[model samples]
Target chain A: MTVATFEASAPFHIPRWLAPFVVLSFAYIAVPFIGTNYLFEAILLPFLALSLAGVGLNILTGYAGQVSLGSAAFLAVGAFAAYNFNLRIEGLPLIGSIILSGFVAAAIGIVFGLPSLRLKGFYLAVSTLAAQFFVQWALTKFSWFSNDSASGVIDAPSLSIAGIAFNGAVGRYIFSLTIVSLLTFFAYRLVSSQTGRNFIAVRDNETAARIIGVPVLKTKLIAFAISSFIIGVAGVLWAFTYLRTVEPAGFNLDRSFQILFIIILGGLASIRGAFFGAALLVVSPLILSRLGSFLFGDLFNSGVLDMSQRIVLGALIILFLILEPDGLVSLWDRIRKRSVARLNKRKHVGRAAQPTQ
Target chain B: MSGFDWQFFVEVLIGGLLSGVMYSLVAIGFVLIYKTSGVLNFAQGAMLLFAALTFVSLVERGVPFALALIITFAVMVVIGIAIERVVLRPLTNRSPMTLFMATLGLSYILEGAAQLIWGTQVHGLDLGIDDVPFEVGGVLISQFDLFAAAIAAALVLFLSVFFRYTRVGLAFRAVADDQFAALAVGLRLPRIWATVWAVAGLVALVAGLLWGARLGVQFSLSLVVLKALPVLVLGGFDSIPGAIVGGLLIGATEKLAEVYIGEYFGGGTESWFAYVVALAFLLIRPSGIFGQKLVERV
Candidate 1:
């Protein structure tokens, strides 16, 4: 290979310029704790919960190459299961019940995942759609799933760990942050292990992976099991820490598509991309609605805003897919690389100008 | 002890079948697009809503009903051509997954655009067709139902003939089978795509007009149009006959479940019963009733 080829393939290194910005980001996240109740509860907590879900989905569709459209169904299952467990199993700790619900979700996820062995792509997608319909049906049919609540909604009691009650916004934010950080760390480690490599292999080519003794079916089932467990935990957190009272209608097909959009716009197959994608999905709508109201005032009410939002969102997705299929993460990477190259060029010019020095 | 009326059952059955025919009309739009483009137009249902809304709004403005319909149909056809030229052709080399996502986005875009242009409020649409119920042997059927069924059948027959014997139809089939081969033989792919989308638009117009007459023209039209999805799933994406058969089966079963088994679960099974049927079908016959058996090299 030529010298240029070797240089091009070299491992990407972060530039010094971005280091301070990365440090400041952590500081910004910490600022929320010092903020008032409204900001913490209404915004940051829910946003974090959504970010966790996005990351959970990133594990399945992004890393394992499974295109699931029934993610919201699993989220619903987790929420309801946790609610039931918390109510029925007397004196059970909240964390324990939530963890137990994850197992239930993983089991259901694996059963639904069995179809993946015989089908894939669009076929698999439709199969998952079945899961969405079935779960919603079961929820509506079996009133016990919603605890026979009059409105088909479930309310979870405040979570307490060893008598440290997380009852409000501040308690909830810390709880969410702690859980998200732990899960993210585990996800990072999981993605770096042998199991992760197998997942990538199976995703890249299942049949080839099978031929090469990668245990394709088992690896895929494992991916589904693990991914569902994470998603289930995220769901439990969402219902308990965020919404507080959950219903079947709240976790509908639109929610599923919204998650799918997050992953695609975040950058498929990248962990950090989930966070970025979630932030965009959450933030852009807020910004757009504000702008819409400012421009049109009362003329563009919620109904009109909703319609325009749908149109703009659709157009943006198509535009992004055509122009930047790799998504926002790749765009960030490209910008960073360009800046680094420019800096290097300046350094080289200065050295040449120094002559014998 | 038990006094069950057989005539009521017959009435519901006939009503269900007529609705099935209407669903088949919507499914046909999907079939034509899928067959020609190999992309499941998730927005097919939205197109129906848009066309019906446009037709109703035009007529409500004092335009002649017939003139409004023709004009609305032409507008839908133009939208079809625009979709092919602007959105689809650029996505030629992308994966089917990408195409699916694109169509989902397109569906959202169309629904939003429909709401924007036509307003979200519901509108009454009178098609100048018969609305009285027909009675025979103690059973009753709506005259509008018969009209819808007859119109759907006529449209399907016309489409079959168009695809089978026409020059453009031949070009469509040729392009569907292999794009590269069609190009080698000197077929203008863009032109073919445009024509196929236009035909799909016409099919959408017929379905929208009938369905809107039944349910009234409104934003909720998109929700009802989603029934086409389960139909497409069970019929196979690219199979026209499959769509007809699938739509009929879903219609019959969903109605039967709602009438008979709905009480067992406190009712409302009608909302998702067809999806359950399709899901079971997917488990049994994943390729669907008439879908081409997929051959994977790997």
Candidate 2:
């Protein structure tokens, strides 16, 4: 089906949520002007990068019905590819380097996605760990990736587009925000199209999707490629814009789990859920720390607090999976539906009273 | 080629085989859980770490070795039952992926709890066996390696007998074949699942002691699971025999590759070698060497 027809037939109208989403987008864009550098640098940049990664993962695991535990591998590939391209290729623009890195990541993604044709479910998920370990090993073992640095840590060069250097917190924020917004828009459009329908079909039932002429293998590969490309770009943003330097260790298995957790907690099969998940993951730790210090004062140390945070995070993940498998987006949708019902009842009551008068 | 020593190669092969048995110890836990419940228990590594830490900590507190072992076993049983009740029971009828993710969450909880309780300090676990290398047929072998292999062999023998002769064993096999059919026949799935998890926990404890003795009880003990993944993939996830054979194959090949070919790659090929091997094996037999073939219906 066409994107327009799909949207028209959707149970929930987009227009109802469009106003608040627009306002939120504007406020996000305006954050640099109104907020502190700490907010822009420490929080917003990482959130956007993680949100983009969540979006990438959401497309594959959420819509396409393939679970990957190696997204950080793609992210590592993206960051390193971008760094190498900018370093070796003379006169290559930074934007070109980042985009090229995405293509590089997509190529590797296709290679790893090959097994998904033969494997299903958790078997496929376990297989993806090969990608995770292999990529990290390659990046660490081969000194060339780090430009033969003894420490194996590489600094991301300043991001510049035609002499416009995104060197500061605000500059990096705007640059990442623009990239995320554009990619998110494309992701939304793609998911609403016939291709998106194919993903959902394959996810719901692969054999049925194949019988319906969905080209199951090709669809799975495309999902992998697209997901890798977006995640790869996020890696570039993470390394160049947020952290400004990285080692392979930075994108280890924990990072992969964190991104997966974001998508799970946000909502599967929803674009907006990626952002919601990212926000929760990034902000929750800050809130937890604040709460810990407030309640315990000097009684609890930072290390103890860190352990407590992990326990809380773990518990929350299990709780969400058991209680609200659809994630925060579905929770928000439920609340919205209920409020709308209550508002309609109030309006009907007012109309009936006026008629009686 | 001229300087290639046949003796060293033989020694390496023997050493790899012995170490492979240790990996089999861990992979067996995975197979037990997967066979009965169809859940890939990601928390197996964390359980290993927890079991090892608890045992070592108890022993360090001047408790007798046998007492410490019993207490650790009891703790694992409790944890297994608690998990089966609280996590897996509520998660019944959910997709395998959801259950897998829940196990991932369980891993985090177990890891955090282990560190919190045990103070995150690395401890050396001595199983009263000296690890000094002893010469055998012109090859150097560790006494500890021989001990580990013996323990693994005994565990396997005992498990095989338990599965064959016990009433619970019959129930386990019935459930593994068909959960619904077993339920129809008056078998309790929750109890069976709990039993399987407890068996897995017991396996983890044995693996933990052996691994901890070799590498010292540390956080990195959890990473031994990575080495076992190749074994799991190679041997089919649900087959006990697969875990054993796959473990041996992975262990031997990884060591051989490291010793012979690692020089070309500047060493450290052992880390990813098994995964690459498993990936290649998947290309040939997607179900693994002993895993049941996957059947899908529209």
lDDT of candidate 2 at residue B159, scale 0 to 100: 92
Candidate 1 residue lDDT tens string, A1-357: 012332443333454435535744563576555679866766777767777777878788878888888888888888888999999999998889888998988998998888777766666776677677778878877889887897678987888999999887878877877787678778877988999889888888887898988998888888888888878888888899988988988888888888888878878877767777777877777788899989989887898888988898788778777888877888877775566566666666654422110
Candidate 2: clashing pairs of residues = none
TM-score between predicted and true chain B, model 1: 0.95
Misplaced by over 4 Å in model 2 are: A1-25, A350-357, B295-298
Instruction: Please compute and give the TM-score of the first chain of candidate 2 against the native first chain.
Output: 0.92
**For all candidates listed, what's the TM-score of chain B alone?**
0.95, 0.97
Q: Write the per-residue lDDT of candidate 2 for residues A140-227, one digit (tens) a residue.
A: 9898999998657889898788899989999998899889988998999999899999999999998789999999999999999999
Q: What lDDT score is found at residue A290 in candidate 2?
A: 87
TM match of model 2 to true structure: 0.95
Q: Write the per-residue lDDT of candidate 1 for residues B1-298, one digit (tens) a residue.
A: 3898788888888888878888888988888887777777878888888899898889889899789978998998899889988788888878777777888888889999998988999888778887999799889988998998889889989988987899988898898788899999999988898888888888888888888988898877776656777877788878889989988888888887889888997887876678778767877887789887762311
Cα DockQ of the candidate 2 complex: 0.57
List candidate 1 stretches off by more than 4 Å.
Answer: A1-29, A33-38, A346-357, B1-10, B295-298
Fnat per predicted structure, each in turn: 0.63, 0.55
